[model samples]
Target: MLTILLTAIVIINLLFIYTLVKDLIKHKDEVMSEPASTIWTPIAQVIIYFLSTFGISDFAISTALYPKAKWVSMKKLPGTLNTQCVIPVFVMALAYINSISVGVTTLLVCIVCQVIGAYVGPYFVVKLPEKVIKNFVVVGLLVASLLILAGKFNWIPANGTATELTGTKLVLTGLLMFVYGALNNIGIGSYALTMATVYAMGMNPAAAFPIMMGACTFSVSIGSMQFIKLQDYSRKITMMSVFGVIGVLIAVFLVKSLNTQMLQWVVLVVLLYSAVSLFMAGRKESEA
Candidate 1:
């Protein structure tokens, strides 16, 4: 199942790479470093996330959510955006959270961590320069991409199913989830962190899914509200996000059958593209 899923994801993403390259060529005059949107970008993301993630997964949504925010920061470019994460985050949450249950304790823990992350993340964002912010975001994307690839290739072993945690270990795990707020805001997103932390505590990947998705919804909501209050976001992209929910609804029932290995490959392609784009933008800035 792992091998077949990985291969399918690879094939799907290889085609997406072609699409990306064509778009890159057409947008050569536009700033390549910015989170760009056409009418199609968000629509395409929803489709890809549905096909690859089995539903409106958090990482996929957050990944979609970041480009708008990326385009919003520092000097606002004309087509750039700030994610109205609140509407869209909950959109996916509504679509998928009810489909699975990970117990009340885990759900509550995820909610608290995410709420804290959502509120705290923006403070960190406003404190930094756009260039520095881009640097961290880009580097973080690369790190995440590598981690996803590692998991796919088994360069680092996937952990066995976990047992419940308690005591000090739980506290330490809590720290990781809290920091994920900052990381997710910085464009690192939260899936890798959730997978590592939750799976480490003994939950299998399947059990971890709903919790991670719920946590990110809260995190992005808090963070998005902060961005919205600042009045520093794009309305155009928000429309794309709203439309993207169609894709989420289409895949809601498919969540239970998803293969983890394939999903990681799809994520890997998106992350690698994001990481490379960030680096290219930084290099362009440096040359200027």
Candidate 2:
């Protein structure tokens, strides 16, 4: 069953990759008009690499790119989000493949729920008010990042050796992942939330990695289609996706010896700033 599931996810992800590549080629001429993207893309990818080294996951890139998209076009935010996720999803699936065996049933539940939510998410996000989407991203970033900081400081209790969840805990985790999947459409990431949820439910924190990765892999790939069909994303964001992979490679191979604690601290600081910047941007939308 595990092998079958892995096979399915790999095939699906490949198909999504093909779709994104085709779009990239078809729209290669459509360079983003916003000059700011040229400056922000490299900066954001650097931040993503730093955060990923600390095990922050693809949510880091989503948070980084969403604001950049907002600067260019509010309508493209969702599409930019879906596009940005492709590289991280592929990288994570390969990196975390072994961890999936720890909680196969729970992982399956999350993937199913999140995939459904992801499929329907783009429709709602595109219609949402600019203020609403921006506010959602701000709140999501604040909540998720703060939770991680809180966990580090031992402000939140989460100590469990269990590898899997059962019964009511399983149901609750599924529901939360579904919400996270929907939120992902608006450029909100599920990594911290999924980590928090599974940890609180007494599952091993290690298990959360694979569960979150697998869920996101299926959900984002399925969700990107909606954004593509709507033509609601910026075409130029694809270039940054290449840089994102490079960031991950450097972090994993070149800088693996860096201080993990310091990296986490730096990422938390960036996430907080991102939250504030997004809040300010949201206000600007309201004023405009």
Candidate 3:
């Protein structure tokens, strides 16, 4: 079931890319000057590399690491996590907003506003200073560290199953999904995080794959279309989409398995590096 679903996903993505590229080429003169124009080829290649090297490998590793994982029919994580979907929803929104923003300080302010708005309504949130953003990045590292530690200690279940859901779980799960759908606007990837949350709550990781992928596909399709219509498309972004599709396909077929622990370690390290890079970028911008 998992294999078939993944294959379908790959095929659908390929078709989407083909159509996008065809449209771009057909309207080349009209779209050439977009902000993401310079990045199309490189983004496509990167996506290819990402899927081939990371995405597929990660999924395989996840399955191997939790072979006994069962399906989760529930709408959300079993307990508190389901009710608290707002937390992740908010975090994801901040992540997406930060991804598209131009300046580090602006990103920092956006993050602050997001965090605060999640708890309270949008108020007089001031622009975050460079130092604050750097601090926030460091804080993110700490949070990631805690999650890793929690997983290692078996303090929390690393995956979930469908059988765990009850009536209440179903209702809450539906609500969480709605929240995730809305949060997709900011560019946050609800897929992995949703999988992780469900897995932690005791659902089958494999089952979570389809749900997350479906949600992401729907959200990204709309988001990408908006970008296309707004002439917000760029070569880099388009290329990323193309290569990302290719990379995911190769990863699904060529990489038969992966080491989950090792992959997690690598992801953690990359995240840390990304944080530092963001900090440095913020600092440089402030100096300039």
Candidate 4:
């Protein structure tokens, strides 16, 4: 069974690579304007999933290189939000391909955090200045990056959550989710934050994922519904999410094949990149 699984993962990875190459070739002429190439939506989603599986929660990374040139239009954001529920539900229901564990307790925490955050997020936006919230996010990202490095270099003792996940640890995890859920409405990547926080707590990437992805669905759904009600979301871009379903399946295959340690390495690289990107974003915001 394990051998079959590995073989399948390799095959899926190859297919994804093939498609990515094909897109690059086809878009070679127009590479500058759409430097990300054709099939960019899935590429972005894949990178977002890969980096965020730990703490690099960026939605912009289309690949190891070649990211989207800029942010998505806010009108397009809600239309694509459907992927949040679809992918996670597919993952949990399958539960074998990409994740290690999908604990009921973890899912519960995620759901509560996301729903409350989503429902209340607009209020927070109204209350707090956008720049202030973003500045705080930059600081938090730097702190998280340092935490990952400390763990890597053995510079500090383990925070207990890294050793054993207790009830308190779990609730704190949910609170982090709540914060991510709220900010996600404004373009923060929840997956990256969730992955980073859970890793810091010493939970397995597999376990962290189900909780992180599963719960955030509620927040996205709420936002999507609002956009639909307000008629502010773009149906065309939303329809493109269907194109990413294939990539989601491929990602499940790829991640499932990785054990905890490999996932950790991939995640660390992503965390560092995300930290740098956050700093860049902060600088841009400051200049503005």
Query: Number of the top candidate by TM-score?
Result: 2
- Tens-place lDDT digits, model 4, residues 90-145: 33324433444444556666667776776666444434564564454455445555
Q: Residue 241 in candidate 3 has what lDDT?
A: 36
Best by lDDT: 2
- Ranking by TM-score, best first? 2, 1, 4, 3
- Candidate 4 is scored at a TM of 0.57
Tens digits of per-residue lDDT for model 3 on 1-288? 334433544554455456567767878775545333344434434432343233222222221211122211111101111111222222222222222222223222222332232222101111234355245434444455455555667766755545234455544554555554433332222444454555654655554443444444433443443334344334323433333444444445565556667666765665556556556656787799
User: Whole-model lDDT, candidate 1?
Assistant: 0.55
Preferred candidate (lDDT higher): 1 or 3: 1
lDDT: worst 10-residue window of model 3: 72-81
The per-residue C-alpha lDDT of model 1 at residue 107 equals: 58
Q: Which stretches of candidate 3 lie over 4 Å from their true place?
A: 1-27, 30-155, 163-166, 283-288
TM-score of 3: 0.54
Give one digit per residue, the lDDT tens place, for model 2 in 1-288: 788878988898888878877877777667666443687776776667455534675565456556555554655666676666676666666567653456778888999999999999998888988777767767777876787788788775577788777899989988998998998898777777887887788877678768877888899888987787777776666556667777666765577555667767766787788888878867776799
Clash count of each predicted structure: 2, 0, 33, 2
lDDT value, candidate 4, whole model: 0.49
User: Candidate 4: where is the Cα deviation over 4 Å?
Assistant: 1-39, 42-99, 123-166, 200-202, 230-235, 254-288
For model 2, the run of ten residues with the poorest summed lDDT: 49-58
- Candidate 2 Cα outliers beyond 4 Å, as residue runs: 32-50, 57-71, 99-101, 250-258, 284-288
